[model samples]
Target: MATAYRQTHDHPKEYFVETDTDTEDSDFDDFVCSDSGKSLDATIFADLEQLFQSQGSEKNDQPGKLLCEVQTEENIAEIFAEIRKEYKPTEAEWRVSNIDERKDHEAASLLDDAFESVSSEVEKSGSIEGCSSCAESVNVLDVSQFKKGQHISMPGKFGTIYQHHAIVCDVKSTSGTKAELELIHFENKDKSIRIRKGIKTYDLKNKQIYLKHYKKQRYDCQLIVSRAETILEDFKMSKFKKYNFLLLNCEHFATWCVNGEEECFQVQGALQMMVDTLTSALGIGSRVVKVVQQLVIMSTDEIAKTISSAIVPEIVLGATAGVYLLYCLAKTAYLKMAYKKNNLCLTCLKITLKEMWLGFLVFSSTSVVQLLIYTFAVPAIGSGVGIPLVVLSVLLSVALKMSVNTFLRVLRNPFGKEKTKLSRPSQLSIADIVAFSYYRLEHVAIVTDILDVNERAQTARVRCIHYGLPKLLAKRQIVEEEFEMNLVNSSWHKFDVDDTTSYACEKRLSRARERVGEKRWSKTNRSDNFCHWAVVPIARWDNYAFEEVNDKEKKNKSVEPFFNKYPGYIAEELRLGDVVDYKETGVLVRKQSKVDQGKNVVEIDLIITSFWKGERKTYTIDLKRDDIHVMYYKPALCISMQDRVERALYWEGRRNRLLWTTNGFIESCILKEEYLDN
Candidate 1:
């Protein structure tokens, strides 16, 4: 059996070796020198002796002090040369076994050099308080002292990386007086990094490592140190990247409870006291000011840490978390600006859906690979054994995964009755999917509806054939691959003109003319219902005439007729209450048109209206296009027939009507002569 040997000091400059064999002529004789008949060990005894003695339980015994006192520049050169001599023509087994040791030595040397440089610079700058209860202008860091590198990995659990550079910068007391500042340059570009200053003062008389940290105005360094030490009581190794216990705020409910209105009052008083203390120390007018200042400083370092910590997390979460936060902020800002100008929430769900689908495709594949590795390779390597546990492991893993998914789903929608949840890469809501479907279907419907009626119209045909169908088809084709084909088919063509009872009657009996491929239009034409006579009524008598004239070019031109007046109508200056037949309708003139159009004079007619008085109603005012009141032109006022038609159709559909039509005509009832004066 291989036996563990105690670290022992032998020849100070020579290597130390230990053997478990009772007799000298054992297999370990290979380590023995053939000529001297003595074992040639590979390690130095003096170096180990000094290290073990310095770290021993004794007053005034520190690793750095002992190392510095024993190992000088000459000593380091000799030790390194000796190590190289022993390792030369390196044995394969020794090389493999001592890789970590060699790395540690190399890293220590580099760190020592770096600290020496730092010490030289500090000596030139100012003197620092030493551990001897003496103020000395000495280089704090000696090259031969430190035997380890600051660059280290945080042990246990998460594969987090950390590097710490601390060599006791300054000591502080209960009084807010700090001796020196220790700064570590963390590689981070994020502006939100937080910085926290630690105290490094040692009590030489007490031989204790004194800690100093602030709490409000009065620095409660002792309290912080005591609490931290208490938490890490059992941890012997108090070093960076070591697995040591730490105190955490486990009272989440307490915070929430104090934030309430009733408890907030009590908290406010306590906060006031804390604030007052900080205000005095920071020399700020209010508690808020002091807090903000401290927070700003703290955040400098914290943000850097956060940036560093997030570097690996970004790999797992992808750029989505960061990008999403920025996107939301930007969108919110834009929405606010646009809201001030009266804009709508026009975020296209179609674009969002497309991106989600693509993202899902990539994420799903990655998740499968991750699942396989975690389930198979990870366990095998970590356990250092292989067995026929694949079937049982897979089932257990899948079941646990499925349970987790179910829990998440239940959390999201508590009221839902669904069970046996399976996780999807793209967590799209039913609402989102429906909205996307509706948007696509509406566009398709518009194209199909147009093709149903006005397929021959060049603009309509071109729009459906060239632009509309191509865009709709592209979306359709992509979506079909994503979703089921039956769902798309049914959603796009919701209304059935087939055996559907009432709608079937509405459908044309005779075969509709099929203009496009498989796309047909209604052969049965409905009543024109144009109301041309009512819309642009012909005037029985010409009352007023005017024309737009260019000031730059003076030319004689015939002015247009007012109130749909016929050219053959004898031009006459009409007065109030004059009866005039215009096309199919009779108009009672209450007032004449405005008698001004550039250089040419025009007349106005006031038609009769219900607003007119009994006897005086006979005289109506009819306004011409030139005599119309000029006001601000709003783009919103330009509502097309399509919008009105849609609203009418919506209302009609709510009433369950097969078909509904609107007469596009606006009646401006006014007596002909009513516009004379008033």
Candidate 2:
């Protein structure tokens, strides 16, 4: 009967191989007869001949030949259709497993009725399972007893192998088993992670098959299994890799009596095979199909933030290991050069060991992290284990311990010891130079890595830095604002004269006050709008040192304008009568004056020819020695100066030396009152 069935139905050559044993064939025949010769079909017979013909070819093609034209979707559908038509369900006995015995017995009666109905359908003419077979006994396994295994496939991105799995403990849902098995095959075909090795099956009590998977990491495994449902749905809809988005997969139990090999038996193909079959079924252009494949392969499920948070540290550490290689190279060079004399110097040895140790930590941590992620975190957490909780628990233990140990010494002494120590610069030995260069390169790479992670802002900053002068010059307001009032004031010097003091006394007293202020401000008074001055925040400069201002040492002095007492002004010409005429004018006005707390201060107003008259007239003025050579500056200077003065605003606010400057100017020109506004 087996031989005849093989001849009659185009079962694959491999399926027929078992039939070669005549004794077994007879047994199978008896089973079939008792089941009403349901397996016999004229169409299957024709396909069997084709399988036989193909089998005569190369040994290697045996599987393919067995699969030959008989492997087609149409043929399998027809075969299943025939089987459904012939095998009336009522004729056979069926039972449910993993359920209470009493309930099972009750359910068995329902199952018997269902089988009887299907048996009647088989006795009739048409194919498709009868309504009775589809009804009451839809599922044979009682799912309550089973623990589901994980989904086997992962949405992948960045060339990493993503995989997942779960355990099946309840009476296994046959359909769910097919899904799991299909995923195992899918992983087997994934070339990215060297998963070419075929599945290894474990022989259980029944003829059930299981696959042992090698996962790159726990997280990858978890991610895959969690999204199994989405993946299978995607397969069904022919939208496996529709977009460059996260792939979602999930798992659930359902009935499965249909044979996996049957084409109409839709659910049991791996992602890769799905792609292949889809391409074949659609008969679309290869290019279009290829595009689809790329999308599916790249589709990845978004890991939960909690999972990602747990996962990122491993990635970071891995990246850090890459960075530490640069450090190692630097250290190697140092050992070869400067430390060559005492190759075994304890300090050098310690440094070498320290660096190597750090490198190992980085690498080992990364690898282990990836492993844990794929093996446990992803799968276990994804299976409702609460990933965040698990991650936190793990981090508080290992990460915390490592961090403390690594940072202990550095935290202990951030600065030098009490004793002063002179440091010798390591001459630019070849090793030193190499180490420095390596360090710089690695540092740049690290910076770039960070920037890549924060693409938008960093990219803009890089562009700005690239343009250099344009950004600086175009930002006039910014440049102007950057001016340090203190720096300008420190660079400029001026003398103040009092009514009771002579020139020599004023100069002497001014110098004395400047010296006194120097101790407080720790800076010199310079000119306003000095182009040479750079308004750099000491902290930002990397080269500046911080100093605290001494308030008690602040000088008590007042600035007396040199032009106050004998303020002189030049003449300007006016064309009031159609003729240019000379007029002696006092353009400078005493806008206001005030003295507060023994500090003398004065405000003078001036109308520059350019300000009051655009290049029409000019003024040349001199000041008396006692009046002082005080200069009236713009408000910007005063504002900036006040800001610095409030807190000795140095780069680090070291001293009470806050001064600033402004370029806007007003001339001390003289004009006749006749030309002035009434």
Candidate 3:
């Protein structure tokens, strides 16, 4: 009877290395058989030969070579074992090393021992085992342990080899010892931040494969699972944004996964460093200033010894250092204030450092020029003349250096274009009307024809027009009633109609006072008498326009009649007439005014003449106001309004109309016929 043999293990086709072999006449007749008194079949040997030939052809193009020599049955078994070992699966395991466990031993030595022991076990048993030692224990984390929505983080390197946090995602594993891990990390690429997901494979026994679980102390596992689902959903749709290392980065993302809030410890550290640096710099500056002052006083006695003496050099050095120190202090303060106002992060620190370095470079250049001027020119002249000349030279050198830098900067761009600081109120230009709304004043007319933007005060100078029917009517009634009462008492009461009209006007004035109330008049008087003109500190401007007001009408107001026209008549004429034109040559006014009482205050009288058939009549309106508020309106608002007006004129054959509501809102009704009624 012939004994039979069969292959025990199945190897993948790709792992088999095929080669050509001429085995048509090969036979295994002399090979040893099992000790059970059975002889192997000849057909079994033929099948083995064909298997080699088929595998050889699959791996290699040649047809007469073998991958390995198979002279004996034992050699064939060894080849199959080698193939099975090569295709064995790997797995991932992790363990936490506590400080107490490794207190008596070195961490590096412990890690080396763990790696060596794991290698020996894998070589002998063909599988990794968990360690029992307290210092080097290993816990194998199975694929089932990590759910789809579980959040895990690992330490990794980002830009310039700086350590950052990376999130683990899309974990996979098979029954074999191997496990696959996909890591998602943020990288600053091409001047922007991007999410990069990468896959890696690890063996269970590999000491380098360590994972840490990120759990929130406040939340339970159920809540964590719920939040994780939402976070993972958001992560899938998240896109790359501009990288701000101190504002948003990988560490922030990882923290956000566990907790709802995003934060980075590295950025906090950087900000703390910036604060310390600024505090130290300011302290050093103060000390230097005091020391320099002492040095200057001490060197005054030795100044006349020689022009090349150490005293003159000390003074020069002290002065230059003092100025540079002052500049640094000021620059640092300005940057800190700006960053705080904008709520920016540690990026401003880097910018502040760069600006300080540039300032130092300029200071050094100025010093060099001063030294050259003193050395070359001071010695040629007498000490009496050279002393003043050297001092002048130092000052002039610094000034010239600064002037040249400014000139170069202006030449480089000429326009001095810069990103506008959004925190600061923008400047308003001439012919811009802003609605002044604050306190008791609601939506008052604040016309800025001769506008002045005071950046220091954060305010603007505006010519305010105050219109009140009750107040104007009261003033006119008082004058006309007194005139009529004088005529009635004296013998000058001419006619019955005139006496009756005067009496009616007096009764109307009394009724108006009673109806409008004395408090309103008293408030209006306080505003007109004491707080007529004001310098208002502005936060910002709301709506703005470049509607042109007739300059001639404003200037000629003082010469026209006062208190002769009714308030209603004046309001109607202003609404109907072309007092506010939307077409004029505009100017960017940058003048600043002093906050003085009764300064830049003007009362204007507007006169409108109308002719119907053969009849001619004139109407006069006196405009005066107190408690005027002003603010800088953004120039962009003016440009936008100007464009809208031009478009409305081209399409609708009319100008943009402005209507002020009683509630203090200025409505720009562009090409709308209905709003003209307001």
Candidate 4:
């Protein structure tokens, strides 16, 4: 048997030689015999001898064995050529061996000089030139430079091109040329349904490496180091999961490694695209279904056959034209409803038209491409499959076009003008008596203050007193008993005031009125079945009633002059039946009654006459009082009193006695003729 000896070196070589062990030989003779092992047999030794000889001048010998020389480039090339002809290796295997060697050698040469220069500069400056951390230098390309706890990035190819990141846990190098890295990375698969920690080993030459620098300070370095070993162990015991490209991808993992936050910009962008696509698809789907339904309902047997026999180009053109017409009709109907709902002005209508035009332009362009696909490509594939395919293409085309239009709409202004102003028939102000006109409650109220105004809705919030027993509580015996008065005699009451509550109450009242066969109430007009409160500026009456004149001669005038100078005179101390009438002077007053007495009332300034519940009535009021109370008496009950008061006012020619009308009330107590002349 021949003995084989292998030389121990950085690059090892094997040699075989035959020796006679039966004959004893001296050490020097054995060495000489080993030297001549290359010349033993020409055929068997030719290739092996050449391989050893080309290795270099270095030699090693063992007793009764041949010595082998170091390998060199020329001999290795010859051996590689011979091996290539006889035994062919697969591309993967060839890359694993030969390609890896070449890559490692090239990488080492390129990075060695750069690393040395960076190191010298860092040593002098105490930091890398552009990087705060020496380990995160931008020049890092060789995997040999990867240290434990360092974040590294790898460029991805094929399905994922977003680049992946990992943390280096371990690094090993052979002969300072080839490097191996063990890395740990976090990955989420199946749209974040499964989370996985993974560990992988990679040859330096097979992957491109970069030192990943954090944009912000990384404070979790120690935590990363502590968890790395546990993560790697867990990864080795776990099964692989499917990967998602958008929701849970490689970019998400890399960001997590660097900053402990899981985020991916690519995933965010893709999700937004999906949302827009879905919105467009839903819109198109609804329209397409409606169109198909209409077509099915209207189609005749003859029409179906005619459609089937039509050429592909003609069919495509007709379909495109039909879709555009459908869109135009839909848009016109939508615009009509919107115009009625919003009552848009001419400027707003123009703006809406421009927006529609932009959408139409985008749709036209997409339809052209869809027409081509349907005419040329889809027809060749047979109508059975092509019909559904064409429908799907139309859906996608509409979706894409609408998405672009929506994106552009958001980027620019969709509404090019300010909102249109509302036309309101009523004006809200302080101290205006406003009834809940349409609710049929017949509840009289006095406006204390206007709380809020919604100009867009043409509504206002006026704080008021409901004045009588609420319609809800009118039939309840407890309400009458608690106040010790009839439902009609109840004093001021408070009610909640807001748009929603008022609207709900109005709706309920409408249903009740409809069931009762009552006429529908109008907001603009007053009805005998309903009490419509008028806006009365009673402050203007108070100002006109008590006008004080600064006269030099009458500086100290007192109560005695009122009997001589004016027609009306009534005192708080006087009885109700006292003889005091001033009809000729166009001024009339009455004694201050007990009902006008309150802590808020300092004095009764004036008695203003106004129509209440379709009857004329006099109310004693103080200018300082914040709220006034009025009662709603039915027309039948107050008809006699109203007729008497109307006859008296007419005979006295007090036609402008601060009378209140349905829409609004006159503030001045002066007669209409005198007021208009002034």
> Which pairs of residues collide in candidate 4?
55-70, 55-71
C-alpha lDDT of candidate 3 relative to the true structure: 0.33
Query: Candidate order by TM-score, highest to lowest?
Result: 3, 4, 2, 1
Instruction: List, residue by residue over 462-488, the lDDT tens digit for candidate 1.
Output: 111101122534421101112222221
Could you give candidate 2's per-residue lDDT for residues 5-104 as a string of tens digits? 3342332333212222225213222112223322222223333344434443533222222222122344334333332333321222111111233432
Candidate achieving the largest lDDT: 4
Give the better candidate number (2 or 4) by lDDT. Answer: 4
Candidate 2 structure, TM-score to reference: 0.15
What TM-score does each of the candidates earn? Answer: 0.14, 0.15, 0.21, 0.21
Flag regions of model 1 displaced more than 4 Å.
1-443, 446-515, 518-678
Q: Is candidate 2 or candidate 3 better by TM-score?
A: 3
Report the Cα RMSD per candidate: 38.0, 37.2, 33.6, 36.0
Local accuracy of candidate 3 as per-residue lDDT tens digits, 306-356: 322434444546565666677677757855553332222233344445545
| Candidate 3 positional error at 567, Å | 93
